[model samples]
Target: MGRKTPKSKEKLDKRKEEKALLAEHTALVNKANSQTNPLSSFPAFTKFSKNGLDVTLDCKRVADMDESLIHSIFNLEKENMKNLYDECSWGWNDKKKMEEMTEEAARYLMAKNEAGELVAFSHFRFDLDYGDPVLYCYELQLKQEVRRKGLGKFMMQVLELIAFTSNLHKVILTVLKHNPAAVEFYKALKYEVDETSPQNSVFEEECHYEILSKLNKKIFKT
Candidate 1:
């Protein structure tokens, strides 16, 4: 798609249109990131009380978070994800994982139970991904006790709400193929294989993960 000769007006117009759309996508993502709190819009969504589970949810950047809680979530993530990560092309590296989780750009959506214990978390960021404004979910890990009480579903719903409310084009995540339960969970939530996901013909047996996304119906993705 290299431009050779500057000739036709149609080509010029197409280039202008593409540039304008890219600017809109970048601006939308920038605005979402500039917000004080992504969760601030929906106050009622901060609480989860259903199926005998009661907890409070809050979003904070990794820098503003307490050190202990950061470590706690890191431990929880390792507990829940290490083996799954190990079984795939991405073997778990403690230092690398920690660095990613604590990066300045990272934000956490944390859930705490009645006793004020950290139970589940979703690490996400609002940004321009693959030329689209998206809320990229890095991790969604829950403690064993909170696994099936609809808490995981609730947390995912919160992520979707945040993304759509901020006008992000979609919510995206990567899930390992070995984790059947997790794969099914996203499918149940109506997420489909994203265009960016790997093709079987390309990687064949080496491919270990799938990228999934749910689009904002309000936004038409180009």
Candidate 2:
């Protein structure tokens, strides 16, 4: 091929730049469209019977949750997270951030015992990241006393069920590297670091947390 003239080369480069910009814009639009409004379809509450214990599961818009209740739950987990993450790195004191997560676009799943005390809770959102629809789990926390009663696994199963029913491609979450037990727990449920995870792109650099995901098997069925 002959060497391109300066004007021809300039035109080709401009076209290439335009194409790249358009592709990026298209990806953003797709991601925005993938987000779901969970409150529109999910029930207000559901009940479960596990090991003879009666548990009630309820979903609430973040803004609707009592401020005291939200503070109390976060306080309950504060110490646990401190042990797993740097004290300064934890955002527990950032009330505004918490409020943002609990807003209308988010979903809170509260698990109550037969006596009506809160036993566990999970905060999640239906998000579109990088052109894929994901059920992103922001937090899953249980009272220390209730940790061994299988509540965590039960709640996760419920979350996965919701993801599948809502047509999400996968359930995604982040686990602190210092929290090996949490990592193992997710591993038991078949969660693995995603191929798109930032860890996969870096060269020998360790991340503070691992972005793990489990595909929705139902989404693939014919």
Candidate with the greatest TM-score versus the true structure: 1
Tell me the whole-model lDDT of each prediction, alpha carbons only. Answer: 0.92, 0.72
Looking at model 2, residue 90 earns an lDDT score of 52
TM-score of 2: 0.72
How many residue pairs clash (N, CA or C atoms closer than 3 angstroms) in each of the candidate models, in the order given? 0, 1
| Candidate 1 Cα outliers beyond 4 Å, as residue runs | 1-8, 202-204
Q: Estimate TM-scores for all models.
A: 0.93, 0.72
Candidate 2 minimal-lDDT segment of 10 residues? 31-40
Clashes of 1: 0
